[model samples]
Target chain A: MSGVADDTAVVVDQVSKKFRLFHERNQTLKSAVMRRRRIVADDFWAVRNVSFEVPQGETFGLIGRNGSSKSTLLKTLARIYVPDEGRVVMNGRVSSMLEVGSGFHPELSGRENIFLNGSILGLTRKQVTARFDEIVDFSGVETFIDQPVKNYSSGMYVRLGVAVAVHTDPDILIVDEILSVGDGAFIEKSRKKFLEFTGQGRTIILVSHSLPQVREMCHQVAWLDGGRLRAVGPTDEVVAAYGASIEAESS
Target chain B: MAASYARELIATRELLLNLTMREVKGQYRRTALGQLWSIINPLATMLVYTLVFAFIFRAEPPPGDPSGLDLYPLWLMCGLLPWMYVTRVITGGVASITNNAGLITKVYFPRMHLPLSVALSTGITFGVELGVLTIALWIFGGFPLPWLPLVVQAMGVLAMFATGIAMLLAILNVHFRDTQHFVSILLPMWMFLTPIIYPISLVEDAAARAGEWILQVYQLNPMLHIVEVFRALLYDNRLPGAVESLAAIGSASVVFAVGYLVFSRHERRLAELL
Candidate 1:
């Protein structure tokens, strides 16, 4: 709570998160009791002493290979996983789209899901109600809005989900691999929305494997390698270093 | 910190209300009877109990009744409706956290609201069941109109109790999947321990044979006091003593406090665990 700065949107002060890699998941009562002994070797640090600052109005990119803790860092920033060490401070309200359609109930209609998803993203019901038509229009699923989302095509599902999510009006948005949603046209539309959103002085942390998109959209970039911060700076420099590393590894 | 917690809860009141609405709506969706099944479920169970206990076994209602209705079906319902609510809340709540793994892993909110909203949604069904019970009573000339206020108080206390237990079980089920199966097994045993179909007076003979502490320990079950209060108000049309109602409320508060503490302690880790 102490790190309050006007220009900083988010601060991760040496944050670390650890996970227990149980050889046998001790979820069952018999195993939990039988193997009460703890093993230090199984403890894995997913985010290790990673410190960075995302200034207000910046679109930050987190880039790494699959097991490099990029998503875990974003999850920590979302407060989905509390940091084991240090702290994360945010200057404004934070919302995350870690996965598209994260909270959509298949049984619920698109209209119900709008309210439900909006509330999940921390928007009040009145806010969702005010933007209901806009959301439905943006998703372009107004024709089938009353039908259950389970019946919608996968493209329609992600379209509605992303539409509701982006409209949450968050000061800082954390998105992980959400750009890979929907068909070509919808992805283009979503990219446009992301640019417009960042233009309004909101901060975004984008986590994706698409290097070209990251290079295009991110003003600042942080590269993580094996749960540690490898390099962080302007997008071009870090992306060059990240690209060179991938080339070196592949060679 | 507790003040801030309460303030945070108040600030997120809309999420709680919407989530509860979602629970209530999603549960009965696509069902033939819709939400009427909420009322009919308990009503049918009450009739089944009435047939087996009242007619076949000839179980008597508690002897001392000012309103003098004392019918067995009415007696069974006085306790059964609240019992159903409690069980629903616990069973539903234990699954609430695990069931919404997608939401918990992706978004952040006050996690306690999940179980609390589940309990509240079940309370909606409890309300419908109580209304059906009242109408049924009127049809049978045993409507406890004068005791409506007391029934309201009983519902509040019962909800508090159920929410507390639900919160505790929900968190526990997250850490230990066995807690889910454990609770499912524990519920039927819990019902028999409480005097839903029979009166506490029936246990008097057992207390005499065993010891006085038998009944005292039985009364220690919070559900017993809740059932007793409901039975007194709904079946006998009499007000329970001040001490009795206060004891039920106090015990409920204690469970709720403990449950809240445990839930808050583990709530943050739930995202990682789930």
Candidate 2:
């Protein structure tokens, strides 16, 4: 945990995000009239007063149950949501693999999506051109690069997404369970590529449900439960504590 | 702040270029004709209109004589060409940001780039139509007008104004989905209200006492003034005076500023809304 304080690649200060939950979407006039006053909605804080930092060139893991603000925190870091309160200051170019193939056009070929994905990740055309062959080779989809992405298998799609993202050489990489998408072999390849990326002195923020993977990759870890941080410290200790807390609750 | 914004836009130029190309290519990907459909669609529509209006109504005569030149096709083409471009930009531009909800939600770039890319892509199709129109005119013996440069300048002015409106509608449609429906209904009605099929002279003659007022109100549409400017340049070989041009420019600039403000303000929330 002290290591996070020393290098501080990403700083989250009292960050909070509030969302309006609409009970009735009320698209039609009939529905609008039937809807009660105040419109059956409430303000919900998806993330509240969350503050943490990842050190430069260190792998940090966030573990939580579903709807525990794990993905929301990554979104806040990506600048997708302007925090309702507090500030999130990131020191370098951030690339998020929150959803693989999220930006890929179905009609476009695998080759086109590479350029499209690369551009979305802030790589210039020249940069994408330079690494195009490497990306295709890494994905092992060189034979199907010219085919439309819609026809590609789910595993192939994830492989291409991972390949493009790793090739971006992002300063801070935020990944959300991307490894869970592919098969064992592809996952092994992806893990190797991720290790190579981290070896180049890049900061990584990973969110995963798999405890062992987290413990293996992360130098430090944070546990979030119900939109609040439960614990933050060295990976092994925090994971042990989190596991114990869960078992104790279930029992 | 403006300088920084301009620099950011410039920095994203390559992204914009690639995105715009993607829009153009992605549009007709599985279709048979692909890009040529851009030209063929409008040309086919024009032919249908020409046959119906010319043959049925016998409204094929030029302004003065039937044999002099068939001004009907030229008039219809002038208005239809620009109107097609404007309507496309309006209808398509609105969905530019909303349609790419995934990109907006996942990544961060200048949000304005999305709508601007749609406008630029549509503008390319419009350019091709314009080229085809020029060729048709030359073949018809309309040749080159004395005010060719002025016509080109006016077209430039109109494009700027159209782009500004496109930007505004794009942003508005994201916030209020009604804008999409409203634009669909509004465009054809707008064409009817403008002096597209008929001449302004006919309006002036019919209105008699209220001619000036009606024309003035019509001028408020901005596109009407743009069309008039286009006609004056291409047909009459003269540009509208500084006063009218300035008024058109001023209105377009205002639309642009308002659109920019709305887009930038709500852009951060687009990922959630979409």
Candidate 3:
């Protein structure tokens, strides 16, 4: 593994992720054999030769319209998708809250899911146990912690999931517009937690459609268009360039 | 590569343990009989086999050689329980990657842990079933308590073998969804091919009449030796034949190695594929 500078938090070097666009899924023996091959699809590069770097303690935003593949790039950084080209090097431990409840088992209780979700985010049982009370209290679902998450309201469920995810204590946090979870007060509380995250000099890689959120929270921003990096700079400049492009297109 | 994979596997031990616990708990969350179903399922199948092979067909195989006990259901269970565990692990493992697509696509961990944890959870259920069967063997004066250690060892080897096959097919199933369905239809054929319902003596007899090559081809089936190992330890209260146990370990290691190599080759693409 190549080492990055201590001042650099993340380096995305010429990363590209290819996806298969299947015409007809060849998911049966009959189809596979009759076709005389595994299913073949058109090669589509979702993230194309995108390169950027994040300095330590910088809250970076990936801003793009729908279908720009910013989310794919984030997934690549999170190790969910191995880049077909180039590499991503991170200097610190990373955790991604990609979705509100990515790893929750509906049949398990809220308490059990806290441990399970925490484990999925790379926290050990002992680490999760250490913050068990804080996670539960943050979620405000202590009344129903023992009940299966299937029975909890969607809001309650998302709160518990978010609670477990944010508490994993990663040096670099990845998010996909899941920060504003639950009702008004919980959202405010979680926002404060994220503020504290940046105050602690942690880096965050955020992919969001909300330009205001990006401008408000991000120090640096990378604008993506059609799976390519359009512009990258301080938050205001990139956000303005992205906004003008959207306006030009809508007109 | 293998060293790093093994090291990461060790580092993620807690995740593996929790995944196994989730599998075991999720399996019986709302069931009426709960964990007893693991035992009852085998017993029911044993009763059916005992009736069909021992009663209706009037097949009277030789008793356990040294233990000197002869009961149709108990003898049938000695092999049947292990076979059932094989079926459960394979079926569960082949779908481990595809079934957990939500988790796989969203979060990242060591992907191999999915199938391994499934195999381990199946091993837990198999352990319970084997414990009950061993106790029942004792009740019938089979005296397998002395061989309990060997039973655990046999289970571990069989689980490895099953997990290997599972991991290999799981990648296939992701590419060709029909693999699961195809394996389901083939399982009964596999069970019949093994010596669970009938003794290996019958196979030997057929081989004698047909050709020596017949038995040689039959022995190529690893499950036949696996079943024999269990029957030797739990049913006969003796060590498995030297060659038979060696074959079991050899095939298990080969399969596990192949499975790991193939799975690692394809594991990264699984998120995109799924």
Candidate 4:
């Protein structure tokens, strides 16, 4: 695993996000006119005053139990969710493999989806063309490359999705539970790609429930609990603290 | 802030192009006739409307055409070609963000691109429709060469106006699902009011007895100016009057500016709302 460098790539400073929960699903004008108004159930904070920094060219991991806001934090970093308070500052092009095949159209061929998904992930057509063979090679879906993606097996679909995402070559990659899917061989292949990604001196912010995986890949880790950052330090220390807290809670 | 947004949009032009391609290709995919439907759909609409109005209602074609062409169908198509673009933009644009809730929530991109690409895709289909119109002109009106530029200019204005409305509705639909339902109801009403099937002269004749305000408001319809420009170029072989051209371009610019403003303002909350 690589150690943290001095330069900062991503900084989340006092960021927070609030979600509105309505008493009724009142997003339609008909209901609003009929009822004459809306009733608010509550406004809940999804992430609150959470702050962290990932150094340039290092892997940062976020490990948390479910509902701990790890995914929200990762999304905030990806710029998918705008923070309700404070801000996230970043110095490089960010691509979130938040969900693979995000913009894929089932009617489009795999060859076409590769171009579409590549651009959706922020690559230009020329860039996609240059890396076309490698992407096909990585996905191992070459025989069906020209077929519409609807015909691809589920396993083939995900592998192609992952293959395109990693090829985006972003300065900062935000990954959320992507590795947990796919067959064992594909998972191993994806890990090798991540290693190659880190080898190129890029930053990665990983959100996963896999503590040991985090401990192995990331130099620094932050543990989130109930929408707050509970621990941040070297990976082993934070992961160990999170593990102990889990044991204590169960006992 | 809007300038910077425009700059970013331009910088990400590749994404825009690719997405537009996706829209155009995805639209015809899985259908048997495929891309031919683009031309056939409008041609069929033109034939049906021409049958009803020209044959049944006996609406007069333009007064001075020696080409032996039945002027009503040509005139109707001249107006209908751009109308297709306008309606598609409004309905497609309104649903653009909502339909792509999957992508909007999962990934971060300029939300404006969805409506823009949708507008542009329809614009591409509109191009094919124009080709059909040009062929119709060759057979029916003998293909006036000098008047072609005017037709192209009117098409550009229509595109700008439609894209603007699309951008505004796309974001609005995300916040209120009622927008989707409202837009469908609004489009046919909008089409009837715009004078695509009938000539403005009929409305003017009605205005003399009803009141001048009737014609004044009818003239104020931005699409009225666009359809008039199309009729002027393709049917009458002339340029749109200065006032007509000004009205069409000016109204289109205003709509585009307002739509861009509304879309960018609401873009941040889109993922959350979706």
Worst 10 residues of 3 chain B by lDDT: B57-66
Top-down lDDT ranking: 3, 1, 4, 2
DockQ of 3: 0.84
> Which scores higher on lDDT, 1 or 4?
1
What DockQ does candidate 1 score?
0.84
Against the hidden reference, what TM-scores do the models get? 0.97, 0.92, 0.98, 0.96
Residue pairs of candidate 4 with colliding backbone atoms = none
lDDT per residue, candidate 4, A81-153, as tens digits?
A: 9999988888788998988888999999999999999988989999999999999999999999999999999
How much does each candidate deviate from the true structure in C-alpha RMSD?
Answer: 1.6, 3.3, 1.4, 2.6
Per-residue lDDT, model 1, residue A154, is 91
Residue B176, model 1, lDDT: 85
- lDDT by residue (tens digit), candidate 4, B75-162: 7887898898898888888898989999988888887888888888888898888777777777765555677776777778888899
Highest-lDDT candidate: 3
Residue B84 in model 3: lDDT? 90
Q: Which stretches of candidate 1 lie over 4 Å from their true place?
A: A1-4, A36-41
Candidate ranking (DockQ, best to worst): 3, 1, 4, 2
Runs off by more than 4 Å, candidate 3 = A1-3, A38-40
lDDT tens per residue, model 3, B95-212: 9999999999999899899999999998888888888888899899899998999889999899889999999999999988888999999999999998889888888999999999
lDDT of 1 by residue, A1-251 (tens): 56467888999899999998877756777776677655323889988999999989999999999899998899999989999998999888998999888878888999998998898889998899999998998899999999998999998999899999899989999999989878888888888888888889999999989999998899999999999999999999999999999999999
TM-score of chain A of each: 0.96, 0.92, 0.95, 0.94
Candidate 2 C-alpha lDDT tens digits along A112-231: 999988987889999999999999998999999999999999889989998999898988998989888888998888888888877888899999999989988899998998888888
